[model samples]
Target: MLPLQIGSFTPKAPVVLAPMAGVTNRAFRAMCRSYGDELVYVNEMVMSHAVVYRNDKTLTMMQFGDDESPRSLQIYGSDPDMLGRAVHQVCDEGRVDHVDLNFGCPAAKVTRKGGGAAVPAKPKLLQQIVRRAVQAAEPYGVPVTAKFRMGLWDDLRTDITTGRICADEGIGWIALHARTVEQHYSGEARWEAIGALKEAVTDIPVLGNGDIWEASDAVAMMAQTDCDGVVIGRGCLGRPWLFGDLITVLNGGEAPAPRRLGEVAEAMRRHARLLTDHYAGFGGEEHAMRDFRKHCAWYLSGYPVGPDVRRTLAQVSSLAQLDDVLGAFDPDAEIVEGGERIKRGHTNGPIKVALPEGYLDDPDELAIPDDADVMALSGG
Candidate 1:
């Protein structure tokens, strides 16, 4: 198979982990990275404002383990200057080899402030942000990419126009989530849109995101859209091994056997262990495991989880506690039939996008709205 090149850097595989907040931390990224040398694991979303302000939590979130070969960090912000500075700092500090800007987030909090998916609604503002970031990263030889949605809504889709802009601005590549901010993760992704994005831009590679729950789905997406690669988010929530499966399938090899409960259990344990290690500074293993509670549902999804067992696992405060719980459960059971493709992240959208007032009055508004400044912190 061929390598997926981003500027001078190359990923072992064309698979990339979408930068989901809270979930794609060092522990999680390390696990996903272990799946393959080529699979690109992007860090959780980092706010450019926070990075500019040197916010401790946001800085901590930017930490990457030594194992993340071809490290990529996704940064979100509305201010062109702030984003450019953030990208420059990351490059100057040698924090990562690649930087992906987030223009696809559809959360109300993000759009309310004129950030995230909202920036793409204003082509001029989007152009400036992308342009400044590219200029900043170019000096360091760090490839910069942008991931965006179809548009604010179907009536005002910007996927094609945004694709053209990124191509002209020297962006390394473009990723289209194939849904509008209003669509969230609810409706089926429009693969045809990915094809349209690919067709519209001839200079840079185009990647497809959304609805790739299984390795087969990635294969199907590539075949259907002819995209350069796939960006996976909620698909790997409790299934980091999906990266391995993708590698196997994309490389002309059969995917590994179905993960039994025991296999999943082992993965969960490793994840917990990594969490403990990652948080050793702020708090030790006990405190770190507290955060692991949220992952219980995803890890045990479709398992025969009893309420009592679920409660215990959710509240597990230490690695030993997790082990004891695993000890009592049978590990050979497989994930429930057809559970592999469970809808995990990004809800469907019919919600109105909270753009700044008059955002839609003119699509040609060239000035960056004051409301569109970078969020102090970033998330979905």
Candidate 2:
């Protein structure tokens, strides 16, 4: 596979970890990076206004490990000036190596104000946002990128248009989620849209997201769409080692065997510890353990760990409790057949796309939404 070059940085593999709020923090990133080298792991999405205002929680969320190379961050906002200022603030402080604008978030709180997926409906506004971000980061030699859905919905597609605008505004690259805002995280992603975007935007690299549950699925996306790389999101939810499989298969090697129950347990223990360390200044180990509770069911999804054990483990309040619960499992046991393909993360979608009143009335208008307070939302 060819390397994914954005500006002066080039990852060894054309693989990027999609930013997921509360999921792609430093600890989780370290876990995924441990399995593969030279991969781009983006921090969770942060609000531009929060960064500009220096919100403590937002700043804490932006922290990167000292060893993390080529730190990448994803920022979302509806106002061009706010987003631009946020980009400038981070770049000026040398806090990030790459900046990605988020335009695919379908959350009602975000889109109700002509932000997120709704922005693409107004091509002019989308252009301004991408251009502002690119211009802001250009002085610092940081490449600005973007990730967006197919469009507001099936009838209001804008992937190709979004790609062209990004390229014209000097974006490093663009990733298409291949699903409409209406589709949310449900249904199959249309790989054909990725190919169309790749074909339309030839100047910069294009990457594909959505439905990449395995290494082979990533391979299929690149082959079918000729996209430069693949962005792994929900696919790597609990299986950080999926990065290793992706690297191996992309490099023409066979996928590695799944880890046994014991190995999985060990990884979980390490994740819990890392999270505790991460939350030390914020909420301490207790708070960290609570955050990690959601991951318990994910880690044991396909394993025959029984409902009682799963329930108990999900409520673990401390590392010792985590260990005690995990130790009861059969270390040698393997995930059930086809367990690797089980779905994780948000599986519901195809909701009504919320937008400002008469938001779609003028696709060329350059107006921002009223009282949206998009900066309050965290992730898309």
Which regions of candidate 1 deviate over 4 angstroms? 1-3, 367-380
Taken over the whole model, the C-alpha lDDT of each candidate is 0.82, 0.87
Clashing pairs in 1: 12-38, 13-38, 183-349, 186-347, 186-348, 262-331
Q: Could you tell me the lDDT of residue 35 within candidate 1?
A: 72
Per-residue lDDT tens digits of candidate 1, residues 226-290?
89999998889888888989988987888887688988888889999998888777676887788
Q: Which regions of candidate 2 fall more than 4 Å away from where they truly are? A: 1-3, 370-372, 375-378
RMSD (Cα, Å) for all candidates, in order, is: 2.0, 1.4
Give TM per candidate.
0.95, 0.97
- What root-mean-square deviation over C-alphas does model 2 reach? 1.4
Q: Write the per-residue lDDT of candidate 2 for residues 264-375, one digit (tens) a residue.
A: 9999999999999888889989999998988887888888788888878778899999989887879999999988889988888879988888887888999875422554
Candidate 1: C-alpha lDDT? 0.82
Q: Which number leads on lDDT?
A: 2
Residue 253 in candidate 2, Cα distance off native in Å: 0.7
